[model samples]
Target: MIRGIRGASTIAYDNPELVMQETKNLMERIIRDNEVLPENVASVIISTTADIVSAFPAKAVRSLPKWEYVPVMCTHEMNVPNGLPLCIRVLVHVNTTVPQNEIKHIYLNEAVKLRPDLTK
Candidate 1:
């Protein structure tokens, strides 16, 4: 069966290296916590707020060694009024035998404030 894991994070700046580091950390955490292997990941989709047009958040994740085989894509989030800024969201699709409820999702950095209930 195909299961989905969700995660979100925000960057302090638009620097490529900073974004890459944070994205790597967030993805690694999600994969580890959910017990999902990179080989089992079907694809990863990332979206960043318009304020982060400097670099694609997906680029940061694709550079990771564990994610070498995973297909990754990036896009801009819907510009809803009063939406969070400098945020990058990720949705990972993995082929797994685990139950949906068992999957772990992550929200880190300032993005954690966006979903404090989930973080705890």
Candidate 2:
């Protein structure tokens, strides 16, 4: 079966460095929490709020040796009124035997407010 692991994080600044670091942090947590292996990942989709134009968040994962072959895409999130700022969200699609209800979703920093129910 295929499953999706969701995660989001806020960037402290609008620079490429912060975007890359925060994206990496979110991805790492998602992988750990969900027990995901990059080899099993089907694809990774990442999005950032419109205000973030420093870099493609996918660039952060591209540095991972196992993720080199994983298809990754990055886009801009819709500009909604009062939407979270400097936020990067990721949806990782993976081939796994894990049940839907067991899947773990991660939200860090200010992004935690987006899904209080999922927060640990």
C-alpha RMSD for every candidate = 1.4, 0.8
Model 1 residue 117 lDDT? Answer: 73
Regions of candidate 2 where Cα sits further than 4 Å from its true position = none
Clash pairs (backbone) in predicted model 1 = none
lDDT, candidate 1, 1-120, per-residue tens:
888888998888787777788888898899789887778888999988888867677877777777777899998999999888888899999999888877788999888877787887
Task: Please estimate how well model 2 matches the true structure, expressed as its whole-model Cα lDDT.
Answer: 0.91
- lDDT minimum window of 10 residues, candidate 2: 61-70
The local distance difference test score of each candidate is 0.85, 0.91
Q: Which regions in candidate 1 have their CA more than 4 angstroms from the true location?
A: none
Q: TM-scores, in order shown?
A: 0.91, 0.97
Candidate 2 pairs with clashing backbones: none
lDDT of 1: 0.85
